[model samples]
Target: MSLDQAAAVMEQQARACRNMAAPLYADLLVHTAEDVRAGGPCADAVAGWTGAPSTAAVPLRLLGGVHALVLTGQAPQLARFYPSAGGAYRPEDADAAWAAFRAVVADRRDAVRGWLRRPPQTNEVGRANLLLAGLLHAVQESRGLPVRLVELGASAGLNLRADRFRVAAPGFAWGPEDSPVRLPGAWRDGVPGWLREAARSYPELTVVERLGCDVTPLDPGSEDGALALRAYLWPEHTARATRLGGALELARRVPARVDRVGAAEFLAGLDPRPGTLTVVWHSVMRQYVPADEWARVTAELDRLAAAGAPFAHLLFEPYEQDGRHRFQLRARIGAGPERVLAEAHPHGLPAWTV
Candidate 1:
């Protein structure tokens, strides 16, 4: 890279790392620079290098794009590359940080060309909800009772409508014969049906609370709120965008309201009412919560569990495994043992129960 090119890269890196503490950013930059030099995916993407390069540019650009879209809600020229339906270029419609990076590169022209040629894969939003349903079933089985779920990071609160919104795993062979979110396989057959039936048996099994916690909570009632929900979507997941729209409509119909609050503080104050089967569930929420806040949340939960609190908690997290994203389901009671219930695709296509 030329001196100017190197300087530009450094400047971008500095800005990207600014959110972290200064000391942390310095160390992170050093390690990240080394990782890029070693041909990491991050490095290649930013430098506009081609064919099996690093992905460093990816996170910065994507995150930046999301921020840009969230802030502006305007048409991004970068949308040409991603080509998502439903106003993908409009920042306010969806999360733009990732999308903006492409536009940012488009302006760069000289340095980021090669990297911008290919867009990152969309995170499968639909699959994520499917995994949550199975996790709910597993938790129900463990507790020996129907579950009343309370969700954190509810997003548009679509997953909370699992029963009402029809779903099918086109990629797998397990689920209802007539489903709305049709994918590529036969239904997982037995348990899913049983769970569905059980779900129906209790029409009055209301979600005591299907609330969410967002530093910036999204209220579907507002146009901007709808856009923020759009900004987070990856362009490749058309099905998800469709489903999100549907969920948004459902949310309007029932309006599953989310309480904007700190997760740790929220849980701390929540004394699950006696005899109520409360399941404190979080799906893909831990990553966003700050480390200190996360520690506090866990600590509070531990205190509740120690008291033999009448709550069954389920966590559905998608993490990288062998260069791919996969979901894991684990259940715990207060500080009790966290039992690993299943591991599957981040989307609901494939899953193996423990």
Candidate 2:
């Protein structure tokens, strides 16, 4: 993309990120802003979003007061535009202040756009869901009991513990006959029944093994990490934070077992025992891997499967430009076709049939 186009895209992304970030930091913006300005992934992330690398660093400091104002929930519109620590705009001039902020951003659009050019993560969740559902489906197809799952990008391992959550359908239906927590997401039209049947059919599913992969696994109970997690949430998504907090509680009690490893290489060396079905899965982790590494990973998996190794691969991933998250579940049983049992969502919420 041209520099200008790239800039626009960056600005667009910033706007979207703002929608998610504003609300998250409202409660602890003042305290967190200090943390944000201290220089870390969070600070870098905020700077990246604002598009002013030089001034980008400043936003982190402002985060404290700006977020505190938001948490107050009174005339937040003005607080959002003019942080409480004395600004050019008075609280009384709400509309004008917002307009002014927009104007400032518009003037700096080029620089901001340059920084916002990171790849989009839109269909990532959908892709993850698709792969997950397909893996379970494969187990049922084989009449296997008690599946084992190993995932990359465990992200608090929430999805890894998906079975523990109630998955529902449109007509107020649910899955896992005796699941504990209710999952939160919009299920596809027929997904509930399909999922329910999948569960019943795979009654043998014991989930003997479940683990995840991540460079840094966030702990909600940790005061420091909780702030970071909250900041990552979108301002418009209070419910998501609440859900995340709930997930955190579950995590503290029963966290996703994860192993730190390089994505493709890690899976390559992993050897599954005979008769014990080994599955390798990932959700939207491709973006993080370099092309060469991704190629190596693919080749490695192919070799293992070709050797007649008893293994399956599930990928719930998306191709962003098309806005489609295809579920691709491939299994190797004897010298047979690289079977694709199903394709669902990267995140499994609002899934589509492929």
Reference-based lDDT, each prediction: 0.51, 0.49
**Ten residues in a row with the worst lDDT in model 1?**
19-28
Weakest 10 consecutive residues of candidate 2 by summed lDDT = 118-127
Candidate 1 residues lying further than 4 Å off, grouped into runs, are 1-82, 86-131, 142-147, 169-205, 307-309, 318-326, 333-336, 347-349
Instruction: List TM-scores for all candidates, in order.
Output: 0.60, 0.63
lDDT of 1 by residue, 191-310 (tens): 345445534444323455565554546566568566555645544445556766765666676656567687887777766555555677776667767789999988877776666546
RMSD to true structure for each model, in Å: 10.4, 8.8
lDDT of 2 by residue, 225-249 (tens): 4544543344444445455555555
Error of 2 at 58 (Å): 15
Residue 158 accuracy (lDDT) in model 2: 59
